[model samples]
Target chain A: MRSVSKYFDGGDTVANYKLDMEIDDGEFVVFLGPSGCGKTTALRMIAGLEDPSDGEIYFDDDRVDGTPPADRNVAMVFQNYALYPHMTVRENIEYPLKVRGVPPEERDERVAQVAELLHIEDQLSSDPGEISGGQRQRTSLARAIVREPSVFLLDEPLSNLDAKLRLEMRSELKRIQNELGITTVYVTHNQEEAMSMGDKIVVLNDGTIRQVAEPQELYRRPRTTWVAKFIGSPPMNLFEGANNDGTVQLDGGNSLPTTAETSSPTVSLGVRPEDIALSTEPPDTDWTVPGTVKTVEPLGEYVLVNVEVGGSVVNVKVSHTDAGPGDPVHLTFDPEDAYLYDENGELVA
Target chain B: MSVESYLEDRLDRDVDGEKLTAILVFMLPGLTLFAIFSVGPMVYSAVGSFFTWNGFDIGQFAGFETWVATFQDDAIINWSNLRALEYPMGALPQNLIWMLVHVPLSTLLGLGLALLFADLRGRSVLRSMVFLAFTTPTVVIGLVLLFVYDPQAGIFNELLRALGLEGQVRNWVQEPQIAIYALIAGGVWVQTGFSMLLYSSALAGIDPALLESARVDGAGRFRRFKDIIWPLVKPVTAVVVIMSMIWVIRIFAIVYAAGGPSGGPGGVFSVLGLEVYQAAFSTPIEYSKAMVVALIELVIALPMAWYIASMD
Candidate 1:
């Protein structure tokens, strides 16, 4: 995609979308964002299901902006699977080949191959309504990949499944993409799924691409406060403070040393919950900020403690914590772990 | 604000008696009207079919005499007329022709219009214009068609004259060979709008993603409709066909209005429904015989009604 934009309602409602990106052949890229963020629109544009209001889309070396979807050699799995409810599983998988006028023997052979690959051979004769949701998903996958299209797209395909089934299909989808080696674009609001499945995650906000990088890079070095807050589970804790010399003065009347170089007087400092250490006893350094604990949530491996500092709550993840609500506590982080952002929400260092 | 808490403030006693009273209060009006209007007439006609009852006097028990007379009535079931290709066909076979011609043409035209208007700009306005005929009373539609098919003043002849096919123009309603077809065409026009509306709503209820997915799966426009859309809307087609079938079987007022109460135009436009009306209300009324014909129509319609009910 090169500078692609879309407008709805005769261009009256500008969607805030202008996309320019590339996906290498066989790369599994995930477009991650919240609802109404235009991630699905971008995917649809690539699949030729939607035409760009401006710019062009290229597949390999050919410009395909004017091509219809059937001739584009792209297949998409819709959010609901969108299986042909009237057809049997075999017929559904064989539809593309049947439409393209492939020979009976070849079509059967390909349908059987894709069905075995998706582990749905036993469901071949069953109607789509007769099968379970997970089986229907696999059948849709079979249908999409049976044509061996150069590009594949999926729009939140696992969102309708049970949590456990979603988790299982997550890895299954990744494995299928790797085996097929077709360039895939997956749209989802789930950051965890993006992190685990994407070769590179494209984080979007308000219809614009915020950052596109490896998941680990996005988590560690987010370019904007929005990305920083969006990528993490508990999210990064941010507080408004003033930067003076080589130290930052917290709004709660404490000062912490920072390594980030910034000339802005007013800045927002951030640190991930896991990067901050919580102590029941007050630390012996001025680098520590004292607060009262508001809530504690215990996971099997760690506890998320919400501490009130300067009338705002900051979450800290620790290996173990016995502090309850209203208990006084202190939080400390090394200067190297703190991130400095200018007032514009752009990363300053 | 919770349901249990809200209920706690109210007195709760006599659950069974109160529930029964509420159920009766809600069901009484609708059930009473249904029994009086629908079931009562059905039973009365059925019992009347077995007796010698006239409009004004009680007569002897007819037993199966009226039933035998229904099949023997040349106007009702003319076996020789069944082989005729021209005028003077039996009313029963004419009703069959109405089903064969009007039902499919109306439904398929409706489906075609639905597909054409599916993505067209200003579709709502176009749909309303097309549906205007259906919203009009059928008698009014018949009257309008009668004028439109008039020999001298009708625009149909003007259109034919303008197209330079002046020789094809004729008196469409008065001709014995063409009169029933003219009424059938009017029937199709009135019915297409109803089926079109039904088909439009059915098409709207389908998930658009299904079509989008098919487009991406290498299916072209015609192929997608043939495989996906047509199959999905088959239930709606069944409904339209069955309902239209019932309408064709009991067709009376439109034909009567266009051809007069005697089903004139040399009686070629007379149908079973018209024959029943003529038998009951014509001079020397055969009330029981009319009931017998009504019962035959009931027999044909009952299975379709039951089938529609079982679809749920």
Candidate 2:
């Protein structure tokens, strides 16, 4: 997709910004964004479900924007599965082949093979409504893969499943994509799923791309504060502050020295909770700030210590500690982990 | 007594008399209306079919002789030509043939129109224009169609003449062989709108993503309708077929108005409903024979209704 834009309500409302990206062949790229961020819209344009209001789309070297969805050779698994309720699982999987006039024998063979691959062989004769959600999802996937299309698009396919099944299907989807070697574009609002499954993750905000990078690269070096806050579970905490020379002053009256030099007078400081260390004793570092512990949250593997530094609350993740409310603690973070953003919300350093 | 103890005693009873009274109070009006309007007439008609009585007098009990007369009457049934099955040149046979032709033609045309107009701009306006015939009273439709099929001034013949096929023009409603077909065409025009609306609403209720999935599966428009839309709307199609069959079987007003009250020409377009009306209200008033025709229509319709109900 190159400079693709979409508008709704007769070109008055923009749905997608000028989105430019290249997905390589056989790459499992995930378009990650919140609702109304045009992730699904972008996927739909590629699948020829919706026309791009501006710009062009290409499949390999051929321009495909003008082609209808039937001739596009792209398979999409809708979020609802969209299996034909009247058909048996086998018939549903065989429909694409049947439409293309493939012979009955080949159709049967492909249906059987795909059903077995998805572990739904026993469910071949059952209607879609007769199966469980997980089985229905597998059936939908079978229908998509049976065609062996050039690109496979999935719009939040696992979102309807229960938590355990979603995790299980997430890996199953990745495995099938790897085995088929089909170019797959997955759209998801769950950052964790994107992080675990995508070869390249495109972060979108307000219908525009924020950053496109590998999962770790996006996490380590977010291009903007929005990407930083969106990509993590306990999102990076941002603080209003001013940066001068090599030191940045926290709004709560704590000044921290940065290794990276910056000249911006007004900046926002970001620190991931896990990167902050908490200790009962004063830390032997120039970056330590003193605060009174306000609350303690005990998650099984790690504990979150919320401390009141001056007036702002900063969360610190630590191994099991005998810290409680009203206890005084010292907070320390590596200067490299500190992120500086100018007033415009763009990363300065 | 204390409130809790009072409630416990109430709960221990097998029936709550006051609550039962309240429920019956709410249900009685609707049940009584249904009994009076639907069940009462059906029972009265069934009972009247067994008796020979006029509207004004208590008459003798006639057994199934009236039923036998339906098949024996020369004007109703003649069992000479079995190959064409026209031997029974009766109201019942004519109505059956009408059902065979009208139901499928109307429903298929309606389905086609629904598919054509579904996503088009000004769909509601176009649909309303097609459906205008349905809203018109059957009597008015019959009269309008009567003029359209008039031998000299009718638009159909004029169009045929303008197309240079002057030899094809004929008396549409007066010709015994083609009069029923002319009436049926008007019937289809009215009924097509009904089936179109039924199918259009059913199509609208379909999950759009399913259609999108079929498109991505490389199924073109015709294949999509066959593989997806047809099966998905089968229940609605069954409904349209059964309703149209009933309408065709009970068609009297249009046939009476378009073709004459006496079944067209030599009674070639006569139907069962018209026979019932003629037997009951024509000279001497053969009420028993009218009941017999009505009962036969009821018997045919009951099984068809049952079959459609059992489909899903």
lDDT of each: 0.85, 0.85
C-alpha TM-scores of all predictions = 0.87, 0.86
Per candidate, native contacts kept equal 0.95, 0.95
Model 2 regions more than 4 Å off: A1-13, A259-263, A280-282, A290-292, A308-312, A321-323, A326-329, B1-65, B72-90, B147-171
lDDT of 2 by residue, B1-312 (tens): 974456546664654767656656888899899999978977887887777786746477787777788777644554452245642377877788889889999999999999999999999998998888889999899899888988799999999999999998998888766777888899999999999999999999999999999999998888889888999888999999999998887888898887675788767788888888988888868877777788888898988878877886
A62-83: candidate 1 lDDT, tens digit per residue: 7787689999888899999999
| 10 residues in a row with least lDDT, candidate 1 chain B | B2-11
Tell me which residue pairs clash in candidate 1. none
Residue-by-residue lDDT tens digits, candidate 1, B26-55: 888998999999899899888878888757
TM-score of chain A of 1: 0.93
DockQ each: 0.71, 0.71
- Please report the TM-score between candidate 2 and the true structure: 0.86
User: Can you list the residue pairs that collide in candidate 2?
Assistant: none
Query: Lowest-lDDT window of 10 residues in candidate 1 chain A?
Result: A3-12
